[model samples]
Target: MNNAPQPHHHLSSDEIDLFELFHAIWKRKKWLIGCTLFAGLLGVGYAYLAPQVYQVSSVLRPAAINELDALNRSEVYKLPPVDALAKVGARLESYEARLSFFRANPALFEAFQRPGQSLEQSFEAFNKNAINLTFPDPKNVDALNGAIRLEMQYPKGVDGVAILNGFVDYAIKLEREQVSADLKVIVNNRLNEIKGKIDAARANYETDKQSKIARLLEADKLKRAQLEDELSAVRLQMKVERSNRLVELAEAISIAKSIGIKSPTTPSALGAAASRGSSQVMRTEVNNQKIPLYFMGTDVLEAERTALEQRTNDDFTDGRVAEIRKELRMLDVNREVEVLKSRSKEDIFLRDVEPLWAEEARLRGLDIDMSGLKLVTIDRMAQTPLSPIKPFKAIIIGLSLVAGLMLGALIALIGHFVQARRENGPFPMPDRHLPHPQKHTH
Candidate 1:
């Protein structure tokens, strides 16, 4: 025997099922074709119904090579080095610094916020919402504040989606300027603080000096007037005393001369035989007494006048009022200080910071001078067609048709099996063949 169970004398379950499928297709060809058509149409519709989108990429770098030294701080007398330079060490990377600018300075943030029908307009519109800008929520603000992050990786040719490019470049430049402005604000606040202190100190100094000077001047004037009066009176009194002393001395001298008082007996008894024989003879003859009276009264008067003048000079020349004079002199010195105090004005330490503050204050009205930020184009303005840059309509439709055909064939196969089973009646079974034949033989 060939064995193998004689190959079952017919087909197994797989072969039988395959033959059934083959037979069903032949019988229900119309239905199978119809299902295939449906599936093909479905696939065709899907492929063509998808929407198309275009995307553009841009590249930008942070503002570089800013001439920070161009800003002048030379005249500032007391500014700290950092304050003078207005350098916070490139804090533009810190969203916080920029955030503060946006929060504190509306116009500043607004300028950064892209405007008018732009890809970035979503950020700008938020500025109008008072709640958003007024009370910053970092979660909400991070995206808005993110400096323009340009993607320069791909060279999407000149026809690229360049719409968002200019704004982004402009934005980064604005940011650099804004950062510089923020630094300036810091410097300004510091300078203002020093200015305030200097002003207050000056005002206070002026106040104190003025008060003391006025008082000192008044006292000096009063003292000088009083001294003048006293001196005049003293002079008159001195003159009178001098005259009296002179008169008294002159009268005494006159009396002495008239009485011949100078002829007293020679205490050096006959020390010199008196004027020899004449002396003895003349003395006895007429008692000749010659009074030494050459302007004796006038000499006494002159001596009296000299003594009085000496006393007046001594009294007037003494440094008795030195303190008052010194006080007056001090007042005069402080007067100059007061003039400076009154005339002096506060200096603007961060000159450029002012426009920044104003720009920050009035965003729409920004006359911001970005010249100082020293911006350069690391990535020049260039455009490329947006990707899926070239829309291959033909290729897309071709792919669509191929996919549709396959889907259609698969649907047709399943539908054909369903319709064929119904048409062929229930599954076949072997004939009974009047099975009793075996019983009868038995």
Candidate 2:
């Protein structure tokens, strides 16, 4: 006989009582109401205890056309666009920069009531209510403007008006310093470049002048050497010519004596010149006397020799050679340096400083005008805010009521199930001590 237990149609106590869900909630109505009221009271108390924050704010607009035009009329140079100032402000107030700002300005947290808290916590709290810069939505294409609005919460015990003014002052100070530093850099760079040009020009002039002088000196030296060589040759030629003339005069006298010509001039002057040697003969001419051909030739040669010696001496004593040496000695290598040094650096800087001067004045004027606008004009100066922005009372109460009702309902259902399980007998136990039960058959 096949022994198999038939599947029993059954419902366990653990099964969800779908039809009785409403009745279960209705039975626990008192508990749900009690939980809802308690949660609502807690919400109201939180709203009462939260600290209130008050905001101080200001607004800025681009420089108007009239303002810029007025400044232009007064100055030769034009002022920079207003958007530049706006961009700097935006950069200073960006998310990353804001973080640094809070850390830097600890006084922004001086209002906190919590004692013994780390400055780290104070800085964190200040960040929560830190300064903000808002711009028009990018989506509103036509509405986009250069106007910026600044807002920050007032700290306890510190004057809100003073803080707002301080921030504006700091921003303007920052812009001015940046402009000054930029101008200084530009001016310094330009001056350095000019100095470099001057140095280069002076160097080039010196090099060229030195090279020319060197060449001139070399040429002069070569010419002087040549003159010395020519003078030596001239002296040698003069000596040979003097020897030949003496030999010719001696032969002519011998011939004259053989021909029986007797003259006092020939025997006395000519014989004396021949016997004493030509070196001793100083007279260039014999005056007022009838002379022989040999004597005449001797006089002519003496004159020629004297003239050659005078010419050679004159060449060495020439004024033009002295002039060349004088010019070389007086070469002024520092002419350009002296001229350039006469002009000071301040003079040069002032000469080119017109534009930078104008720019600085323009920025200063703009800053002054901005200050007249009450430092960007307060948008909504902080008043003592009577109410806090956080822990919205109405919202908290509503949420708490709903949450309590739901939680209470779940607990009530779970309790109901648990009680039912307790009243019912223990679930059929599977005994590990006995062998597995065969399929039960009637």
Candidate 3:
């Protein structure tokens, strides 16, 4: 009979022995408990030793339409609440703005300093993850509300609330100053434009006035020349009439000397002498012819001729010459042109001046002080948090215990395999199912 140990028919190579596997694990129960306790203690120590981080956040919303009414009415700047919120969001996210805030307030970030890190390096670390900005989703229905959230995370002993509030105020103030500067520039540019128009209008008015004066002066000169010509013609006519009178007197003197008349005689006197002898006979002849010039005595004719030859000034003799001279004196200066040239207030006389001045006054009167302007409304202000946000004790302990249990189980399995290999052969049969080695009775 063959006495070698025979393998059990019920047990197969693929089948695992549950009793033996449990027995092996049970043998190393002390190790599993020790590892679990050690891992739990480590978790507890880490939970207690890590720095506690606190979070503070604030909510901001767009201002109401009425809040921006003054700015819109001024027409200098038209900013809507949505755009204002966007600007605030931009400022909140700017790295430079954050750095500026950090520099401005040194006490708030003093806790971030480390031993070997420079101030700038510490700030860089803080700036990397400390500030968080959240904006409303555009795809959502409430996007028109234009709400934004600002969050700050800092280690223990840091004043995140004050820093956030101060940064918000600073951003708004900076935006207000920028708006004011832009408004001032626009207003000044408009004022300059109005001034230029006013100046151009005044210049045009002055030129027109000068042209009017020149025209008046030219007309005055023409009138004076006409009067002078009339005066000269009248003087020449008087001189020629005087010479004709002299000739007539000389002819009349010769005729009187030949006819032997010695005194001035009228035509009526000659007619009466011829009709004096025929009063009753009534045989008189009617003659319409005037008496000849020789009938006047030479003494009167000679006296008139002497006066004509001696007259030097014809202006005194003729009324027309005196009138012409008076007119020429009147035309020497234009009163209308003088009045225009001597005017002191030329603006009143200018056309389209009222509108320009009115616009200028309106621009000058605009309110550029936007300090009181409401850019954003703080829905919620940041407050000190009650608890820290890091190092969850329960979760850490639970996960560490689970990991330790797994490691202990792997070690027990490895030890069990090595003992089994040493006790039996390299390929050991199932411990429980293998028949005991029968005594070999030969």
Candidate 4:
């Protein structure tokens, strides 16, 4: 007490002992091992007992974007669509359209495919939904036909051959037409997006042209060193290549001449003048230019025409887009002539780009192409189980009981250890921490 300060309160030792824990584990070793092994076996059995699931998948190549981009850039007042929402909407719409077309005709589906077509083929053609299609062979016609019908029996209920054929055909056509119709709104939406992009491009081009018009006129008014330089370069190149160009032109003309015989332009007006002909060389001028059929001699007409031609031209990659664009270009231009060559290089490009004004509309059409939806099978076909997959009461109860037994063994071991040590250690000296018997009684 003199050397150090006396403790205000005494501390008590913890009751837990490691020996008891180890002893308990050893005593119930069989229960612990048996429970673990039982749980593992139960897990394996449950995994295998679960039902198998069946799945189907379809695939397709995505359409090109650059072609649309090029179309957009060529327009007067529009720009290419960079919006993700617009694109996703378009893609979704496209998928919807495909699905609509797929569902349109139940009859067509029946007609398009039958049993024995496939269990699982790598690639199968679908008209609308996932209906398969294969040309029916004559030998297999009866079987094929049976496979598609809702019932194995023909004529549905009644047995009139004429009535049945008519009904079946009518049903199929109705289905197909309905599919197209169902897709109409969505397809139209997607197509509209394409039209929108095209329109955007067109609008931008127009804006650009008008904005640049004043500039072009102003430049034209100036001494035009830049234009002069460009003109000179073109002239120089033309001069160097003139002979080869002429030869090429001649070859082109020769090839053109070889095609479909001209009808002599409403029966040759040469009549009596050529009746007395001496072999003096006859100079013939052949009409070899492709002109828009609808154009009269108007600039607007010409613009429209040029637009169609530009889009249809070889430079555009998407065959569908290219054809439509060219058509649109031709539609915008004035009457059919060599008007294409008359315009400067820049003008040509602009005219080509004008059809892109309808890109938004075209995009709208693409958006409805839901038939392009793809699928993948995560799990193969297995019958769905009607009951719950987990909580095996038998296994759970067995494990719980084993756990309880292990716990009991632990308690017993702990009690045994305490009793054994009880007589060995001297009682700790009571100090400030000693509990009063009076407090315990109170």
TM-score of each: 0.43, 0.49, 0.83, 0.22
Backbone N/Cα/C clashes per model:
9, 0, 0, 104
Whole-model lDDT, model 4: 0.41
Residue-level lDDT tens digits of model 1 in 1-442: 2323221254432244756666655565665566556655655565455443334444333233233333332222222323322222233233444444345434433333444555235333432331111111337644322222233222222222333344344444565666557656755665566566656655765676668667766776687677666656665665676667666666755664664444333323234445454464323323355633323444454465467555644344335445444544554454544554465433333233454444334433333344644443334454554344224455655665566555545555677766656776568455444223222221
Instruction: Tell me the spans in candidate 3 whose CA falls farther than 4 Å from its real position.
Output: 1-11, 14-23, 114-119, 139-141, 252-300, 317-319, 429-442
- Per-residue lDDT of model 4, residues 397-420, tens digit only: 566566655655655666655765
How far in Å is the alpha carbon of 31 misplaced in model 1? 6.7
- lDDT tens digits by residue: candidate 2, 55-97: 6677765555554453345433344445444554665465554
Ranking by TM-score: 3, 2, 1, 4
CA RMSD, predictions in order: 12.8, 12.7, 6.0, 36.0
Clashing pairs in 2: none
Better of 1 and 2 by TM-score: 2
| Candidate topping TM-score | 3
Greater TM-score among 2 and 3 belongs to: 3
lDDT of 3 at 217: 92
**Ranking of all candidate structures by their lDDT, best first:** 3, 2, 1, 4
Model 1 worst lDDT window (10 residues): 127-136
